[model samples]
Target chain A: MKRIALLLWLSLVLPLAAASDAHREYDAMETYEPHVRGDQSLSGSYKHWAHPGKLDWRLAGNPEENWKLNWKFMDPPFNASVHGGHFALDRGEQLFRELNAKARFARCLGAGKAGLKGLRARYPQYRADLKRIAGLEEVIEYCAAREGRVLQNGSYDNSAVSLYVASQSNGMPMRVDVGKGVMRDAFERGRKLFHTRAGKLHLACSSCHTHKVGLQLRGSVITTPYGDAVHYPVYRTRYFLQSLHLRFAECNLDTRTQPLVPGSRAYTDLEVFMTALSNGYPVTVPSERD
Target chain B: MRSISILAGLAVALVLPVWAQGLPRDAAVNAAAPNKTLEPRVVTNSGRLEWLPHAHNLTPWPTLSHEDRRPAPKPRKARLAGPLDGDAGRGRDIAVRPDKGYCIVCHQIPGEEWPGTVGLDLRGFKQRQYADAAVYQQIFDARVNNAQTVMPPFGTNNILSEQEIRDLVVFLQSLE
Candidate 1:
C-alpha cells in the first residue's frame, strides 16, 4: 500500500516539476537577449530592434541609402547557373527599380500626387465608389485599374508598393477614419475577425500577437501588429521576395485555423485591424527580416 | 381410407429426394459443379469472369510448364525518400524541436501561431514529388541548387546532425 502511494506521488510530482521548469524558462526569455549575427555578437544596440521612437525618419527619402535591405534579399540562387549564368542586380533588380519609378511618376490616377508616403496610416477607410470600407491595397488596385494602368494583383505589387510608400510615413500617427456608416461597419468587421476564435487550436489573432506582443517565442520576440502594417511589401530573407500580403496570408494559414483567402473579405478586415493598430506608427517599407 | 391411402403414397415419394439432400458428398459435388473442370473459363483483365473456351492454341492446349517460363518485370526506382524510421511521434515532436531549430522560423506553415512567413509551406511536400533522395537533399542542403534561398541548410547548419535530419525528413514526408 505504501509503495503504491509513493509511486503515485512520484508520477504526479515529476510532470508538475518539469512543467514548472519549462514555464519558467519561457517566462524569463520575455526580455531581449543578445544575439549573434554573422561573426559579431551584436551588443543590445545593433541586433535588438529599436522601439518605434528610436528609428531614424530621414532615410526614407534616399533610395540608395536604405541599409536595412540585406544581401540575402538581393542575391540570386546558385542553381540559376543552369539558366544563362548567375545574374546580378544589373539584370533583374535594376529593371524592378525602373518599373517602380515609372509606375510612381506616371501618376495616371487622380488619387493625387505621389502621396503614398504615410498613406498606410489612413487605410481600410470608406471609399465612396465601393460604398464599403476598403483596405489601402484595394484603393490602390482600384486606382490602378480605373486609371488604365495595369493594376498588379492586390496580394502582389500593391503590398510591395504599400511597404515602400508606407516607409516614407514612418513615425507618423495612424489616422484611419472610424466615423459612422461604411467606415464603422468595416472597422467592426475587422475587430470581430481579430477577436474571433477559430481553427483546431481555437486561437484568435489577438491571442498571440496582441496579448503576447514582445513576449518571446523561442529566440524571437513577438512583434505587435500595430506598427507592423506600416511596412508593406516587406522583403523577407527566407524567400528573398517582396510581397507583404503574401506574408500576411501565410500567417493566417499558419495559425492552423481555416485559412482566409488572400484577397478575401477576412484578409481585408484583418488588414484594417492591423493598419489601425499602427495608426500612428510611421511606415518602414522593404524592411529586412532575419 | 381412400384419403389415407393417397397421403401414404405422397409421403413415400417425398422421402427419397429429401434423404438425398442430406448427403454431404452430393452437396459438395453440387457446390463444385459451377466450377467444374470440364467448363472453359475466360479471365478478362477487368476481372469479369466469363465461361468460354480456355485453350488459345488451335493444335492443342499449351503445357503448364511452357506458361511458367516468362520472366517478371523489374520494379521502378523510387523518386522520393520513404518515411524515416525514427520516432514518428518523436519525429512530430522533433519537427517542432526549437532546440534542433524551428523549420517554421524560415518556412511559413499553416496552423502554427505567429511563425516567420519566410519560406514555402512544408506541408503536402510528399505529394509534390514522392522521392526519398529529393527530400533528403531538400532538408540536407537546399543551397546545392539555390544559394539565394534564406533557408539555412539544416544538416549543414550543424543545428541538426545527419541522424536528426533523417528523422525530420521522415516527419516532413509524413505530412499530407
Candidate 2:
C-alpha cells in the first residue's frame, strides 16, 4: 500500500517540477505569433486567432537590451540562465555576434538602402517590408522542419523568401568591407573556418565551393562563394527561403562539424568574410539552380 | 508455486518499463518533427546522401563495417603506432565516397584527380615525415597529434570505424 502511494506521488511531483522548469527557461516577456496560412515554414498559431503585437522581434537596433530574446545567444545573461559555462559560451558568443551583426546589416540595407549602389547599395526594390517579413521565427521553423536541400550542383536549394530578399539588390554590386578594425578578427576567424576541414566529412567550405568551383558534385555544379551573400534570402525550389546564416549553418553541418546556433557569431563572421570575398560580384537573389 | 509465479510475472513487468524508458531518445534534436512531405533525394559527389540528416540536430551516425570492431582505449596517444590490417581498395572507396571519408578533398593522391590544396599532397607521402603510425594517427583523429588540427576525429567520433581507419592508412601509404 505504501509503495503504490509513493509511486503515484513521485510521478505527479516529478512531472510538475519538470514542466515548471521548462516554463522558466523560455523568455518570460516574449512570445511568437505564427503564420496565418498554416505554413510549416512559418511558426504555427497555437489555439485560436493571433495575438496582436506579439512578434518576438530580434535586432532591436542593437543587442545590448534584447539579450533575453532567445535569439541573442551567448550573452552573459543567456549563458548564466542556461549554465552554459565559459569555453562553450565564449565560442558561441563569437558566432552569435557575427551572425547578429550581419542580420543587423541586412536589416539596415533592407530598411532604406537596399537598392542603392556602392557600399550602401541594397536592392532598391526591397524596403522595410522585406525585413519585416524575414523573421528569425521562420528560421526556427525551418530548422525544426529540417528542410534544407543541397542541389547536386553545389549551390543551395533556397526559397522564394530569400530570392525576394536577394533580388532587392539586383542592380547593385557586392561591396562588403573588411576594413581594419575590431571586426577584422571576426573576418580572419571566418576565413579560417572557411578553409579548415570540419564535420564528419572533414571537408572545408572551400573544398567544393572555392577550390573546385566548376567541379561536379553528383549532378550539381559547384558555385563560387563570391557574391553569394547578396542574395540575403534565396528561394530554393526544394528548400525554400534560406537566410545567409542558415546557409552557413547548413554548410557547417555538411562538413560534419556541429553548427553553432543559426544567429551565432561564427556564422556571422563567416558571412562577413564571404561577402567580402565576393566583393565585386553582382548581387542576385533567388538564384536559379538545378 | 502459484504465488511465486505471480511474483516473477510482476517483477518482469516492472523491469520492462524501465528498459523501455532507457531506450535512446532524440530529445537533443527537435528537428525530427513530422514533415508534411517526404524529404527529397540529394545525390552528392559522396554518392547518394540526404541533407535532411545533416539539418537535424546531432545524432550518432549509423555504424557501418564489422571489420576491426575493436576500439582503442580512449584518450590514448597513437601518433607513432603503425596499423596492422588495411585494405587499399576499401580505403580508396572511402576516400572517394563524398558521404564517407573525403580524403581527396584535401590531399592529392596518386591516380586520383580532383584533389584539394588545404592539406599536404599525398602523392609523395611515402618519402616524407609521415611514418606509418603517424599516418594512422593523423587519419584516426589528427587532433591527438596536433590540438589545433582542422581534421575531423574520424575514429574518436565514430565517423569511421577502426577497420575503416586502417584501410585509409594503407591507401594513403600506397599513394607513392
Candidate 3:
C-alpha cells in the first residue's frame, strides 16, 4: 500500500511540483526583470529602464567615429563575399559604407511628441474627440523633421542621412510622449499599420515581432517590436548604412509593399508611433545586424 | 502492485492526448509531391537591368514590384522534390524553432496563444482540398507562383533542408 501511494505521488504530485516551480520561475521573471522593450505601459517613461550594470552607453562620438559603443548590437549583417562582389570591391571590407557618409542629423521624434502642446495650440482644429487628428501633410510641413534642413538627395539621400540624425540620441532612452492625446492618435495609426498584414507574404509587423518575439528565421532572432526601435542606424553589413526608416522601407519590400520614402511624413509618423510604443527603452544606435 | 499499475495507466491516459497531438508521427512522411520547377526570370542579356544600382541585398531578392506582388513567382532557385520518410516530431520542432522559418509567426499553429491570422489557418487543414503533394509544395516554397510571396523559400533557399521539408509536410498534412 505504501509503494502504491509512493507511485501515485511520484506520478502526480512530483510532476505538479515541477510545473508549479516552472510557473514560479516565469512569475519571478515577470516581477524582477526590467523590460528591455515592449512593456505596453503607456504611462511609463524610458528613464525607468536604468539597469545599473547592463550596457555602458557613455560615449561621445557619432556612429561614424565610434562604432565601438554599439559593440553589443553587432551581429554580422552581411555575407562578405556576396556584398563585396556586388559592389565591385575586394570581398573583405565589412565596414564599407553604401549610403552617403555625410548624412546629417535631426532631433529625435520622441522629443517632438513630448513638446506637441505648442503644435496642438497652433492648430486646434486638428483635434477631434479628445485626440488630435493632425494629418500627415500638416505634421510634415510644420515640423520639417524636428528642425532638419531638408538635405537634397531626394528625401532619403541614401543611408548616410539617417545615420546622421539618429546618431544624435545614441546614448539616451527611447522617449516618445504617447501618454494620450495627439501622440496617442499617431501611436494608434502605427499600431493599426503594424497589425494590418500586407503584400505577397501577407505579413504584419505584429505577425513576427509581437506573436513570435523569440522565434528565429534564417538564423537571426525575430526581435520583438518594442526594444527594436532604439537600435536605429544599424551598420547592416548586407545593406551597408541602414536607418530605421530605411529598414522599414526594406520591410515594405520584403512584404512586397511600395516603400514610402525615408524621412517622409509617413515614415516619421510610423517612427513616432513605434517609438511611442517603445517609450521606455534605451537608444542603442549604429548597431549591426543581418 | 495493482494500485501502482492503475495509477500509472491513468497518468498515461491523461498525457497521451497531448503527446499525440503535439508530435503526430515519429515515423517518416511519404514523398508524394511531384517536382514543381519555376523558371528563373533574370535573363542576363538585358545588361543586368534588374540588378539594383547598388546591391544592398534589398532588390533582386524576389519581385521588386512596389505594389502587391504576392501570388507571384519567387526569384529563388528551383526546388526538387523533397525527401520521403519525414519525422513529424522533428518537423514540429523545426516549425517552432526561433530565428529560422518562423512558421508559427505567420501561420497559426496549435499550442500558441497568438497564432497569426496572416497565412491560411492551419486548423482544419485536413478538411481542405490539398493533396499530399500540394501540401508539401506549399510549405516547401509558396513563392513558386507568387514572385513576391512572403512565405520564405525554405527548400530553395536551404533554410529548411529537404528532410526538414518532408517532415513538415508530414506533420502539416496530418493536421486534421
Candidate 4:
C-alpha cells in the first residue's frame, strides 16, 4: 500500500514541477523583449498590440521616473484590468538614442563639405591593424573600442549599430586615416581581395556586376556599387527584416564565391571595404525600399 | 490457483482507467487524429522531403533518414568558399552567382546584367558620404535600421557568417 501511494504521488508531482519550470522560463525570456522584438518585424499591428502604457512618462532624462509608454485607453485581447498599462517602447527608443550619441566614426577626418563624391573616388584600400583586410564595420568596431568606450562584439555587435547611427554624415569625403601600418595593410589586402576570383561560376566580382551591370543576361539588371551605404536598415519587401550581412552573404553565394559566416573576420573586412567605397554617401536607416 | 487468478484479473481491470488517464486529454479524445493527414510533404531548399512524424509516432531525424533509405548529399565546396574581398569584380560576381550570395534577385543594381528592380539600386553607392565601414555596417545588418526588409540578415541568416561578409565587402569596394 505504501509503495503504490509513493509511486502515484511522484508521478503527479513530477509533471506539475515540469509544467511550472516551462512557464517560468517563458516568463524570463519574455523579459528580453527588446532583443526579440527586432525579429518579429511585425506588421502595422505591433504599435497597438505590445505591452500597455503607464502614465509615468517622465521628461527626457529625468532619471527618477520609471520609463514607459503612454497609450490612450483601449481594451486588449487579454486581461481587462491591465488594459491601459505601459510597454517599454519609450524606454527602448531612449536607449537607442543614448547609444547613438556616443557612436564611433561620427565624423571621420577628411569628410569635407563637398559630400560623398571625393570619398567614393578612393576605396578597396588596405588597413594596417586588421592586417588581412578591413571595412566600415571593422573601423566602427575599432572606433567603438577606442572612442565610444565599448566592446566590439564581433561584426554585428551593438557597436556596429552605433556606427550606423553615425552614418548621418553622407556626402562627406572619406577621411580614412591611412596613417597606421595595420590600416595600410588592411587597405591593400582589401584591394587585392576585391580583384581576386574564386568560385564555380569562374567570374570575378567586377566581371558581371560592374562591367556588365545594367545589361540583361538572365532577367536582372547589373547594379553599380555606389551610393549603397546611404540607405540601410532598409525595410525590404521580400525579407522579414532589414539584413545588411544577409545581402553581403547572398551576393557571395550568388557569385559562387566561398561563403563566410556572419560574424567572421572576412565578412568584417569586406564590410570595411564597402564602407570605403561609399565614402561620402549619407546614411539613411529606417529606409523603406521595394 | 483459482484465488490468485481472480486477483490478477481484478488488478488488470483496475489499471485500465489509470493508464488511460496518463494520456493527454487531446490525445485521448482523438487517438486517430494523425490518421487524417496522409503523406504530407514538407518543402525545403532541397525540395520536398517528408512529412513530420505524428506526435504519437515520435521518431528521430537520423533514424528516419535510415528508414527512408535516402542518403544525404555530400557538402559542396562553394558553400565553404568562406568570404569575398571588397572589389568590383567580387561585387559583380555576387550580383550574378546564385549559390553564394546573389543581391540581384530582388534588388536593382544599375549597369549590371538584368539587374533586379525589386529593391533599390546600388549604383553610385560610394556617393554616400559615410565611411566605407559605415556602408559595410549597413550591408552587414540593415535590421538596425528598418526591421522589415525582405533582405535576410545574411550574417544572422547563417548562410554567410561575418567573415564571408568581409570578403563580400572586398569585392564591393573594387567596383569603385
Which candidate has the highest DockQ of all?
Answer: 2
The DockQ value obtained for model 3 is 0.03
What would the per-residue lDDT of candidate 4 be over residues B98-171, giving only the tens digit for each residue?
Answer: 65567776555667555655455666555544455544555555545543333444553344545556656665
Q: In candidate 3, what are the lDDT values of residues B54-149, reduced to their tens digit?
A: 212222122212221223223343444535688878877887776345677667777655654446667766678576676666766665566434
Give Cα distance to truth, residue A265, candidate 2, Å: 6.5
| TM-score of structure candidate 4 | 0.34
Alpha-carbon TM-score of each model against the true structure = 0.42, 0.45, 0.41, 0.34
Q: Give the better candidate number (1 or 2) by TM-score.
A: 2
Per-residue lDDT of A40-138 in model 2, one digit per residue for the tens?
A: 122222111121123234422343323122122222222233321222223323432343354553334334353223422321111243332122223
- Candidate 1 lDDT at A142 equals 63
| Interface RMSD, candidates in the order listed | 31.1, 14.8, 22.7, 21.3
Candidate 1 ranges beyond 4 A from true positions: A1-110, A113-118, A147-150, A154-156, A167-171, A241-244, B1-176
Best candidate (score: TM-score): 2
The interface root mean square deviation of candidate 2 comes to 14.8
TM-score rank, highest first?
Answer: 2, 1, 3, 4
Worst 10 residues of 4 chain B by lDDT: B58-67
Question: In angstroms, how far off is A72's CA in candidate 4?
Answer: 39
What's the CA error at residue A70 for candidate 1, in Å? 19
lDDT of 4 by residue, A70-170 (tens): 11111111213321011111221333355446432333412346532343223323545554444443444454555544423222233224233333332
